[model samples]
Target chain A: MSLLNDLTGAPPGLPPHALLLRLAAIGAVLAGTTCGFAYVGGWLSPGALTPARVIDRFEQVNGPHPGFRRNHAKGLCVEGRFAASGAGAALSKAGLFAAGRVTPVAGRLALAGGQPYAADAEATVRSLALRFTLPDGEEWRTGMNDIPVFPVRTPEAFYEQLLAAKPDLATGKPDPARLNGFFAAHPESAKAAALIKARTVTAGFADSTYRSLNAFRLVAADGRDTPVRFAFVPERAPSPETAGQAVQQDKNYLFDALAAELRQDALRWHLVATLGRPGDPTADATQPWPADRETADLGTLALTGSTPEAPGNCRDVNFDPLVLPLGIAPSDDPLLSARSAAYSQSFTRRAGEDKTPSAVAGAPPHGAAL
Target chain B: MTPSPRFNLPARLLHWSMAALILAMLLIGVAMVTSLADYHALVSLHRPLGILILVLALLRLANRRRHAPPPLPADLPMWQRRAAHASHVALYALMLAMPLVGWAMLSAARYPVALAGPLVLPPILPQSPVLYAGLRSVHTVLAYALFGLILAHLGAALLHALIRQDGVFSSMAPWRPRRAAPTLRPEG
Candidate 1:
């Protein structure tokens, strides 16, 4: 009956039964998709796997490092003064960031992952885990990774990735196909892999940038809440030789470099936070906020001195992000809670081992000196 | 043979274009889940392709609403006729649902849903790992359902052309004058 009916066309009638079937089809689709999603949500979350079990699995696969827990096993503990600027107070009323007030900072620097003996040259990620002890007895702790984005989005996915990366019994090396399959299914991993390949490795800890890679809610004194992700941007430029250089001058070059730098003068890093807009990601650690997002330089972190034995100070302290001050709180990011749980499990296991801290005999109290 | 009536040109164009896009999406989806070498390339391709399919599906729905399709043959069994209508409805629903689900899944996972630099879509839902995982599984399952429905649709079209010799196939693709005649018009 239409103008184009001269060509091939459907019959001119719409039977009531056909219309009813169409309506039923629409209902079925809506119900099916929603129910399917609900079923998946109900079954396959962190609830299906406990943090303790995941840690135990990690130990089973990697074999626990004797003195160190899970990640950043080889580290140098240092004492510092963190002076917050007026800008920091504007973002959060936390005492640690009060204008010009110095908070005692105890922190560690390490090669990423669990191998204590891994060389600087072999490391792909560097870590800067810190704990700021405020005068009011409140503490702000953060475990930062040099990599901008994480390899996976969720802790459950991370557990699966670790299990897949664990070495096979036959060859004593992880199966390449399994890792490949994991990567293929999880396309979010491509961002991290590409970044690792593209960015030039920093020669030492002094020049590297550490990204928190997790969003947190920062509430101001006036009760306005802003989601923020912060980064430790280095004041010193990286040496040209660091770019694509495979050879480390020595096995302990990073630690030696940081210690040497600290001995001369306090090393400074801008503690900056990127403010998140309304739709910014709060749950996923793998996602980086947009570059042009509003950012505030919260303060300066000055590394005053380093300790040869970090086990004395930082080893007992879990640098849990959830250990927030009054004005700062964990975002809904599942990784934040997951990390807190995992860190507790790790701390419990390591402390239970009853391994005595190999205290550097005659070393001065570093935090008190700072 | 009489010059059989066909769907309006806009409807035919939208049908074939969407058919090609959906098939490509299915194949790419399969390849992306299997091969690491192809994963990055396929994912990049998948995002833009998904958005295109979504846009075209909307346009097709609008067109279909204004221009009703030709009716089934009178001799067609009631069950088969009902199946034909239901499948089309399912296919259309999937075309609309898949892209939105993928976008929301990425949002929930806190990943950028972008086709290029500065082109990221706003998050459709808050970041929640549980929600992300669930949506991801739903997207995959629906994709498989879509793929199966497509195959059945193809089978029905062929049966109409070869055995029934009805003009149903021609209703959407009318360039070919005879049942077996070849033409520049692409087959779904």
Candidate 2:
């Protein structure tokens, strides 16, 4: 009787308590259906609400050359220029550059890979580098990753991370010795390294949520700053007990499943930034921000739109942290600062096609966000 | 008694394998560039392989031209034939264009493109910051363009393999089943 009253939109004759229960049930059913379908199909389908709908969904994302990439190589011949922006203007005249946002940004993200085409299941943590030009014409970079605390800290350590993961000198195999150095040198990395190692040996994609162990400084309009780290909490749950058993059966389980999920629903991360405050733990890229310091909910990050399905898996979409808008800036944590330059160099090296950003690179003061 | 004008084994291997590699390359390229720098060596391998694909794609195209493709299926629609022709042209055009643009962009930026050996590829574009930045974006823009074209290519290939089940797929089939081989292989 109470359930019946809660439904029917709670007519004046119905008791308030009864009406409330009915409404709650209906809401629960509707949400459950969406969640169920989300697992089946929503994860892969790129809706108008998709996180990365960078192209023509809303008017805000739309810009002068909506889908254009500024041609640096072409401008080399014609405009005597190398800037992506300048190339865009020149190409627009020649009917070359297509419509895209004027203030272009670039981003790159990746995980540590040992074999050239090794299955992603192997312990591979993620990386993101973004670069954006501000309204004031200044550029800011934000370098981040999926692990909450990085195994290496300073630029020197970052360099060592490269050597540790590099090919062996004698046998041309991945050097196991150097790879173990950081783990041995800093016991703190044992925690980060353990998480990384389990990812390789484990199987459940649901129970596994990755983190960027580095801290970033986000400056707000009120002159307040927040030191933050990134984590991508999985939307679905997989049995932790079965995670190991599943890995033996399927090596590429996480990647393959994620690919299917992407086909259904856009992967979304609630961009929550942990603030460094008097009440919070030290906010340093070298130190893992405690779970308790979780502060502002930055925004939601999702696959906006993929012209081709599984873009990061199947397209040329680079998701570097350096690709930024106006306000977001990278901090002075030596690793974050070095990544900006390193990424730009790596990106330029990776792309053999066309265009370079700027020859003269600059870094801002990192004590706080700009 | 006649050999099908189908691509020679090496040509076919290069064709189909490279098609797979290039597509994989693009995706891996996309993902690698977006990453925060966990594996620099893997990231390092991306470019050399891209340039390698560029070279291999060129050689593959040249071989494709040298040895004519098997005659079009009698039932191939007129539109598909034209599309087939145009798509091949575009594929070759992109395969050739993308690397050069990358090389030129690199040249403009003053970076040496190591072409898988001690020898370095010559910089096609002179050093100019204004030109370098523009070419780099153009390089990236072309990268996206290459991606779009590759998607179209994939759709066509999948259609031929799954829907048509025609000889069209044989051009790049990893191992064309001998006429006597049974079709009991499990699905992907």
Q: Which numbered prediction scores highest in lDDT against the true structure? A: 1
TM-score of chain B of 2: 0.82
lDDT of 2: 0.47
Q: What would the per-residue lDDT of candidate 1 be over residues A54-151, giving only the tens digit for each residue?
A: 67777777676754667677778888978888798878988777788888898888776566666665345888988887643356888888787777
Docking class of 1: incorrect
Return model 2's CA RMSD, one decimal: 27.7
**TM-score of chain A considered alone, across all candidate predictions:** 0.80, 0.51
Instruction: Give the range of the ten consecutive residues with the poorest summed lDDT in model 2 chain A.
Output: A73-82
**What is the C-alpha DockQ of each candidate?**
0.02, 0.02
Model 2, span B31-113: residue lDDT tens = 44433333333444656877888889878877767776766666566887898789888878878887777778656654455
Q: Candidate 2: where are CA atoms >4 Å away?
A: A1-110, A114-116, A126-144, A165-208, A238-252, A278-284, A304-318, A353-370, B1-188
* Residue B170 CA displacement from its true place in model 1, Å: 86
The sequence of per-residue lDDT tens digits that candidate 1 reaches over residues B1-188 is: 33325778998889898888887787777545433223345666788899889999999999888877766666566788899999999999999999999888766654455565225566788755446657877998999899778767876775555334456677777485565322213222
